[model samples]
Target: MDVSWEESVADSINTIYLLFSAYLVFVMQLGFAMLCAGSVRAKNAMNIMLTNVVDAVVGSISYYVFGFAFAFGEGSNSNPFIGTYFFALKDIPNSTYDYSFFLYQWAFAIAVAGITSGSIAERTQFSAYLIFSFFLTGFVYPIVAHWVWSSSGWLSPSSSDMLFGSGAIDFAGSGVVHLVGGIAGLWGALIEGPRAGRFDAFGKPVPMRGHNATLVVLGTFLLWFGWFGFNPGSFDKILVPYTTTSDQGNWTAIGRTAVTTTLAGSTAGLVTLFGRRLLVGHWDALDVCNGLLGGFVAITSGCSVVEPWAAIICGFVSAWVLIGLNITALKLKFDDPLEATQLHGGCGAWGLIFTGLFAKEEFVIQAYDSGESGVSRPYGLFMGGGWALVGAQVIEVLAIVGWVSATMGPLFYALHKLKILRISVDEEMAGLDISSHGGYAYTSHAEESQPRFYADYARLQDQS
Candidate 1:
């Protein structure tokens, strides 16, 4: 097809914007690392950090090799369950736009892989974590991506079996990335079991607070910052090339998505704070942090489709979900230190549902019509009438949860039966930094040797 110079310029500009957006998404890896690092006990700090680093490394290599193919290859011609083309990405064009799109999606893939680390923190063997990261990124994530995001996906409105409405709408990845990651995380936590001392002989859960509140707060802020890129960038909203009359609506979705994301996160944080104080008689920083994230996850699916007011409602409800799930995780005794099972998995499911209940018909028209595919998506019942879209969402979320758990559960079970998943009792007590990596993260004033170091420091200060 012949193209005008203006269209060529637009594509080039969009490519650049996408590349930059991917870089912003890439920084989220650091956020996940720090957040998970701070959420674990002092002994497992380095271990969690290592798991994140390896996730990027392994995730990148594996996803590059075949993951993208399974997710995006063959595009419209792709199979329903998975893509059959682009093995080793051989079919992707050499153009700047294609590569930028590839890189952006790759960043999302890594974040999904990293989410599970927090749930299985502390007791997870580094080898097991590395292996799971490889399979999850190279195989599991890509398959799910194909199921929902790819044009041929059955859950897509464009699919032949869009059983409900345009299949299902996950503006970003509430179901594709977060929910899938959460279910996988929960499965690993359940199979790996709780950390030593996490439960007593009476099976009562014990409190195990993280060693660094500062890091947790910092991590939360960083995640929030990167989320700007995570949500708005999905639509490739660049101001320069997007000035044309036709592109204005795309720009609006981008702007509104960003606005919704910010409002959702802020409202979720405040709601979580109030809930914490009301329930625990004190405001808890970590709960607030998780609440903020839960809100983001919840609004992600409908960021472009839902109004800001709806975003606030989702955020508020997300905070409630986060708090409830955290308590439930403890009650279930899964030993999930990060409450990610609820934050991402539970809230991600809610994010999709939020889209079904509140997505505006006009906004959905703007987003779906302006989308690169030029597809007319199914609308929510509240906006267009009928329960098709919302019901599809419920089915989609359950299917994703069931698929991830069923796949990851057996893999973890095999690893468990082989005794390669969890660490030994001695290693659990000694901390993963020293046990797995053969060293302490801090040696000068060793955290594990705090009593001895503090006593000596007091004596020296007295002499001074």
Candidate 2:
């Protein structure tokens, strides 16, 4: 083949990799759907599943129209708060693989938007939630993306400020995606208030167990499998700058990331199982699943940069955080049906901070210098690096928390004022499947107790 032919082949390989990675990430929606469906009561199964579907549909549209622009756009007018180009995925060359890149990002966008659905699953009105999903993808997620992932982002170590440690080294968006989704979900749930009977008059929590352990475990396994794409496929490019990297640069990153990601999830699940047994005297399958998922979230930021041992530490601590935060949310009167706060928000923060403590100097250097990111974090504490990266991580966490809470609180409250933030108490008691969507997930006599689920979703729509 000619040199030109060789170049085309290489380009095609990268393009194919990117597209396949997007597909893997896209499948995470199914994981979210099954997980949510199983974690909720039987009456809300269909609702949760539909909400997951809607997140991909509405969230993708909004991200294409607005989110991609705010996230990746840049020009003379671009600023740290947002990107000023790529609106509607416009003005980008198709041959540049922009479409494939956009697709991958769109999938990520929907995943983040979907996080809120679980926390507010049983109680949120479908209309209000669709609206929230739309804005969340179009605005909330992209804003954080601009700040965290954009090369020109002020928080990017690649930026010229030299102000903070390595401009908050999140190789894969623990903050922009996971933390953002988690906090937004938390705020939305808090505003909507706890589920009926979730907290008694004396402020004690009541048990509202999920109906299907099988589905929950299945979903967790699916998420774990898809996470191979989530972490390893996070690389924006399969090639690196020849001036800064050796021939095996991309290959090494991929291998290390996959290993670390796997170790963290596996370790966390084991730790959580033991912890739950010690604390509650039983080996809870559900807690183990959540711990595994939390471990994945916790290791995402540092997956490509941390050593395998650090992954174990991140996962081990993350398991405890998952349990502790899940309980704390209850004490705070937040009725999160799936513990979104702990899995995404709390674990994501730990991932970011732990990265600061455990990320290796060479790996961080290789990552920053490898691609167009121009990002370079200082050495982590364990590597004899100072406190700069940790400090930046803390600041970034607090800032994101404030940003999401401030924005989401008002938006949900407005929906509440408009009387759409939640389903009617009557409808909630009846179950959203029957009252809102009008169908039961199952066909057995269990449908008898599910009158609302048995209702005609098409004709009995509750738009008002």
Candidate 3:
């Protein structure tokens, strides 16, 4: 009842930011759909669609039911690992946040978890995938979210405790979102093994490019557009600069962060273009798209601190890093279709490390001063901060990789031992559409009465 007009306006703007961010993230679902449809075999077109569609649906339900609770849970008075209340969004205050903000975060949770589907594609059992998805969205993602973002957690803003020293700053979830998804995908890929014919008798990895490059390009663009929302919308604050006497100054820093994010992505993409050409015989559209994503991931950790030029440098380095990871993954014989291991895992780690190296102390002071105070607050390289910041980032990187690999590895191995990790060899060659899903994406052989269902119907119809 005592809220002023200014307070009301700020509330409204925060709500808008949340909604817009959520919408942008939601649009990324289409990008995933397009990207996966292109990455897999044409014969498995319908299967790819099924997996992608189910990710949004299953991921959303799981996140809403228990994922949100785990991620943002209030946690116990004693336990730092688990969340407390906030499950089912009970008793949430309308004044504290609008529906838009709530929805936006929800979309993000779904998108990050959905990335795993692409890694497990072509050979996974739909039932097993659904089960794994439920646990990931419901529990795995939430636990990590709680540790990093929850107020009560050790590393959260409330505690101001660093995972190492700089306090684990992920501006927009380079570690929380991308790294988690990538690591999960890596485990899945390793367990599933290569598709039939993807390996020779000597166990050499073969190139298994996507069935449709155009779709991959379109999906990549969609993801790029949606990232504008992903990075900029995290601020959850809208500052309208008013010259009135009542302390009317907008938070220009948020806008500056957004600009750096945009510029970093642009430069990262350019660097990737040249890097790919130099490394490979020709320029690849896929590499260009991924290079931009790598930049986005890199900038995400320190987008708020680094200058535009620094962002460009970060992007440039990430572009080459991405290329290196790709080559390394292939050399190591990792069967990562869509190269999720390189795009998210490798680049994401680089981004987190770079954030410590490049983040400015002024921004850290500003971010912390506005909210929390602590023993080892964030301090970056440009601020003449020592290697302490980098040291913290290193610990975080090791913790994430070690925990995820160790925890998920056993599960994948168990599944493999149970013979559930992969489909039969016949299924691999027959394609997922008919073998796994029981029908062609276009039309079922039994459904031929409906001529429109035929794959060749388009050409035949055109002739008619």
Whole-model Cα lDDT of every candidate shown, in order: 0.83, 0.84, 0.73
Error of 2 at 268 (Å): 0.9
Tens digit of per-residue lDDT, candidate 3, span 1-464: 79999888877777777787789888988888898888887767788788777777888888878877777755342245667545547645663573565577677777765677777778887776776777777777666667666665555544545555456677677877788788988999988876778778787777778778999899988988888778877666655443332443226567788888888788989988888788777988877887887888888877876778889888998888888877787677777777777778877898888887888776665554442234246577656787877776676677678767876678778778888778776566666675566556654433653443343434333543
User: What RMSD value applies to candidate 1?
Assistant: 5.4
Output the lDDT of residue 261, model 3: 81
Best by lDDT: 2
Candidate 2 per-residue C-alpha lDDT over 1-464 given as tens digits, one digit per residue, 9 for 90 to 100: 45587667767877888888889888889899889999999878888899999999999789988898888887555898777755656566564688888888898899997788887889999998789999999988888888878777777756767447477888777887899999988888878888988988999999998989999999998888888888888876675443454455576688889999999999999999999899889889998999999999999989988999989999999999998997787788778889997799999999999988998877877677663345545768887889988887887898899889888889988998998888877678767877776566876725576443444343345534
After TM-score superposition, the amount by which residue 107's alpha carbon in candidate 2 deviates from its true location, in angstroms, is 1.0
User: How do these models rank on lDDT, best leading?
Assistant: 2, 1, 3
The digit string of per-residue lDDT tens for model 1 on 1-464 reads 89899888877778877888899889888888889888988878888998999999999998988798888888554688878655646766655667787899899999988898888899988889889999999989988888887777778755666766556888789989999899999899988889999989888888899988888888888888888889999886464422225546566678789999999989999999999999989979988899999999999998988889989999999999888888887777777888888899999999999888888866776665544344456676776646877988888898898889888999999999999999877677767776677555767527657775455445444644
- Where model 2 places Cα greater than 4 Å from the true spot, the runs are 1-3, 94-96, 160-165, 241-246, 371-377, 450-464
CA error at residue 433 for candidate 3, angstroms? 0.8
Q: Name the candidate, 1 or 2, with the larger TM-score value.
A: 2
For model 1, name the residue pairs that clash.
155-167, 156-166, 157-166, 157-167
TM-score of each: 0.92, 0.93, 0.88
The candidate, 1 or 3, that scores higher on TM-score is 1
Quote the lDDT for 414 in model 3.
78
lDDT: worst 10-residue window of model 1:
239-248
Model 3 spans > 4 angstroms off: 75-78, 95-99, 157-165, 240-251, 371-377, 442-464
